[model samples]
Target: DLAVLKSKFRGALVGSLLGDCLGAPFEGELVSSGDKIVIQKYFDKLESPDLKGPIRSYTDDTAMMKSVAKTFIDKPEVDYTYMAKLFVKEYFAEPKRGYGESIVEVFSKLRKRKFEDVYKPAQEQFNGSGSFGNGGGMRVAPVALYFYNNYDAMIDVAKKSTQLTHTHSLGVHGAVFQCIAVSQALACNPKKKIDPEQFCNELKQKMKEVEKENDDGLNLKVEQPYVDKINVIQHFLKAKYNDELDEEIGIVLGNNICAIESVPTALYCFLRSLEEIPTVKTDNIFRRTIQYAITLGGDTDTIACMAGGIAGAYLGEEAINRNMAKQCESYEKTIEMADSLYNAVCGASNRA
Candidate 1:
């Protein structure tokens, strides 16, 4: 079981890295029906054993995720200040990772304030409504993997760490939703086929509780937004895959940077890829998950990153093509980080 878990840890991190690197090229372009064909060929080429283009570079999604995992590995205690410092340090060290303007502001403010109030900069964003961007959800895979066995701790840390940059209820809950999805995927047996209906139902129930606890009674425009998104995901999953259907999903589920839009979209991508996609032409579900996420178009890197993390958590590292994984920049370092996070958690549990 430990061996299987270790492989999963690697799978989740590598999957996240591959998605960011591979999906970065098409982050904002809207994919038409014809574009899917080009996308399919693109994946086919990427998977070729002999193909040697420049390694696909990762974006901010991975840049931030590495900091999150490092915080867990290097600190025996959960330290928000330390994690905040890592995020600022990483951002400043390499400012061209495609970080959004809003987060750049948050990082600068954090550094200026000397991390005295880690959450203040984020809370001050968008006229004090905070960021609803998927920045939180995009980088949350490490929390899911680190607290895979501890559901309450997973939820707690997911919310707190996300609050460091995203305090909006939608942003915070979306990260929670993504974290729960990855952990659920991690718990499934890799040898068994995933039941999409069952997976949606379980996610729906858990999200009900998560949403209920966070109800502020002021934002009544949408009740239980993430839960409603899960229901929509279920509906879309049961429908046959088609270009028209994808259009509807894009309109309804969305593919933007907003956590409410993109996080559920990522979860849907992972679940839908569980079956054969007529266009993708991949028997490998791991590839299907990220590729399908990319095909959805907007915010490609983060959506793919989140979906890839969930898919990898389920399938383990062996299911990912080594060639494809090697194509991502820092792929080796991602594996090492996953291993360190695993050893940190499991090693502590063993000592306990």
Candidate 2:
């Protein structure tokens, strides 16, 4: 039984890396405009060879997520400052692995040893309101597992982590909401599948009060964060412009810049894939999901990564073909990290 849990844990991490690597080489090319036929062609043609490269490494999304998992593994307590320092170090260490412009600026300041000042005028990054990019949401999955037992605590750590670089209301909200969704799914009864609408509604209800409180304190009149999340989820359910193999369905989440757009899109993909598993007649759900991810153009890696986590959660690791899952370059390290993190999570649960 413990082996099953461990294998499932490894599957989650490996699934994430597999998708990240598969889509990293095609980070920005997956965009398709209303040409349904062309979109279908694109999705049908995505190949694993297309993802092969000497530099086909995971991006900031995977790096930060692994760090979050590491933090939970090493310490009995969650340290915000330690996590912030790790985030700064990783961004500065490799500043060119496909970071957004605003994030680039933030990391640039950190590189110049201005880590403390990076957050100073953070509210001015996006039209004087701050960023709403998917960067935050992309890396927030570990927080779901880390704080699964305490929903409020998960929200706090998630907001804190996003605020480290993304101070925008929507950005932080997306991270919090996505993590909550993952946590809920992880803890959800296997017999009772998660209901997409009800999930979004629950998230909206939980986040509305806190978001409103913060907006009131800052004198900023932004709509509730969960509202944006729900909007994305709604889009995911209603918008299916392409086939299961078509890429357009993936990018419909918006250019992956909007956290509201990307996170829910990934969740929707997860839901779609889960629904497809029993009846789709595909032995390669991992391959199908990756192909589906790449056709959705723009922010390919992040979308793929999100979809990977969801698939890993539902399918467990053994369900994925070993060759594809094991093909990851950093296979050993990622699995080790995931195992340690899982043990930490279980240990934490036992103590409680």
Candidate 3:
């Protein structure tokens, strides 16, 4: 069972890395004639012989993901406090990774002998409510894998992980919804045909309960408000990007917090490529999905990473672009971690 799961985990890592690489060269580029002209320009320059800029690298998305993978190898259990400490450690180790301003400040305090006071300062940092960034959802695919056989445990760990940095309800909810999507995909019985509609419908039902029971701050209704939008699923299926690429999807999905933005946006990416599952090549289908996200502009890395996780789970290692996948500095390490986590899972299951 875990062998199958390990294959999926490797797939997700490759998808995440491929998406990050494609989108990295295009971060913040506005769509020109529905084409990522600026992104193409940058890639062209990077591919040139005489370019002088620093090499393009993955931001916080990959770093946080490595942290999650490390936790899986070391703990194999969800420990929020430990996870938060790891997040701080990783960010400090590579201060140049793609951390947000709020995150930067939070970790600064954590490093300045104020470790226990991280959350209190965060509440004040975001006008007394705390951040709702997509940071929580971006690094949670490992949770989906870690709890692939236990949905209840999956939901619990997802919530704790978000609160460590993002204490906002939407942030927590976003992680819940995205993990559900990935886990459900990973856990699907291979005998049955994959149905994207059925998958999303189940997610809608589960998230309804999460919203109703949500006790975090930022007062709002428990139910997500966008489930009924006409052609919403179809739009997602078609990979139809929003018209304006500069503004964040949070504005459409309701801010980049856990619930409103990252969850649905990531789900939309999955839906767009869901039909290509088990057959789609990483360079073609995966690139199209992530490139579409970059064309939407804001929060490009998180969008790419979130959506990339879903695609990766579905496609496994087969969906990744070989060249790009090989270029990932952490590619070999990710594979080793996946194998260790898989062995650990097998060991635990055998004992049971």
Candidate 4:
């Protein structure tokens, strides 16, 4: 079990890296039916053992994810301020990682204000509504892995860490939803097939609890958006996979940057990829998950990254292709971070 957990940790972090790296090149492109063929071939080329090219570069998704993992490994106690600093530091060190304009502004403010109030800048964004973007959900894999055994702590840290930039209930709860998905995937045995219906049902139940607690007396148009998305994901999954179905999913579940749009879409990607996709020619489910996500288009990197994390957590490292993973930037360092996180958790548990 320890070995399995360790492999899952590696799978999750590395899977996230692979998705961001591979998906970055295609971000924001509308995936027409013709485009799916190009995406399929692209994946085939990346998997070829003899293929040689520059390693695929990751976007801000993996950049922020790395900082989150580092924070957990370096600090036993959760440190929101330190985590905020790491985000700012990583962004400044490499400003060209495709971060969104809003988050960049938050980083700039955090530095200007000396991080005296780490959560203030984000709270001030978008005329106090705050961002409901998928930024928080994209980087939440570390929180899921670190607090793998503690459900309450995982949800708590997921919300707090996300609040460092995303304070909107939708933004915060979406991150929590993503965190729960990854945690559930990590708990699954790689040797067994996952029942997609059961998986969504479990997620829906947990998200309902999360949404109930999030009732802040603000009567928003959609009271339980994520819960509604989970219902949509369940509905979509029941239908046979087809081009038409894919279009419906894009329209209904969405493939955009908003957390409400992308997070559940990522979960749908993971669940749908469990079976063979007619368009994608992969025997490997992990490949199928991300490749399917990319074909859905908008916010490609982050959606693929989030979906990949869930798939990889379910499948563990062995399910991921070694040759394909080597094509991503920071693959080695990502593995090291995963191992360090595993040790940090296991070491603390053993000591206790």
Which candidate number maximizes lDDT? 4
Error of 2 at 209 (Å): 4.5
Model 3 pairs whose backbones collide = 11-316, 60-98, 132-257, 170-258, 170-259, 171-258, 174-258, 174-259, 250-255, 282-319
- lDDT of every predicted structure (CA atoms): 0.92, 0.65, 0.64, 0.93
Order of candidate numbers by TM-score, starting with the best: 4, 1, 3, 2
As a whole number from 0 to 100, the lDDT of residue 9 in candidate 3 is 80
TM-score of 4: 0.97
What is the C-alpha lDDT profile of model 2 across 1-352, one tens digit per residue? 4665565566567767777776776677745444334534433333344533253477777777777777677765876556666776877787766777787666555646645554554555766677888878777777766665677788888887787678877788778767776666665444355676776677677767656755556555756646665666666665543355344444445646688667766666666554453212344565556556555667778877877766665456776665455455676788788778777877774321
Q: Over 4 Å off in model 1, which ranges?
A: 217-222, 349-352
- Where does candidate 2 have its weakest 10-residue lDDT segment? 274-283
Off by over 4 Å in 3: 34-56, 117-124, 189-193, 214-231, 234-259, 275-284, 349-352
TM-scores, all models, native as reference: 0.97, 0.78, 0.80, 0.97
Off by over 4 Å in 2: 1-5, 30-56, 111-128, 189-194, 207-210, 213-222, 228-252, 277-287, 348-352
The residue pairs found clashing in candidate 4 are: none
Q: Worst ten-residue run, lDDT, model 4?
A: 343-352
Model 4 CA lDDT for position 54: 92
Segments of candidate 4 deviating more than 4 angstroms: 217-222, 349-352
Residue 78's lDDT within candidate 3 is 50
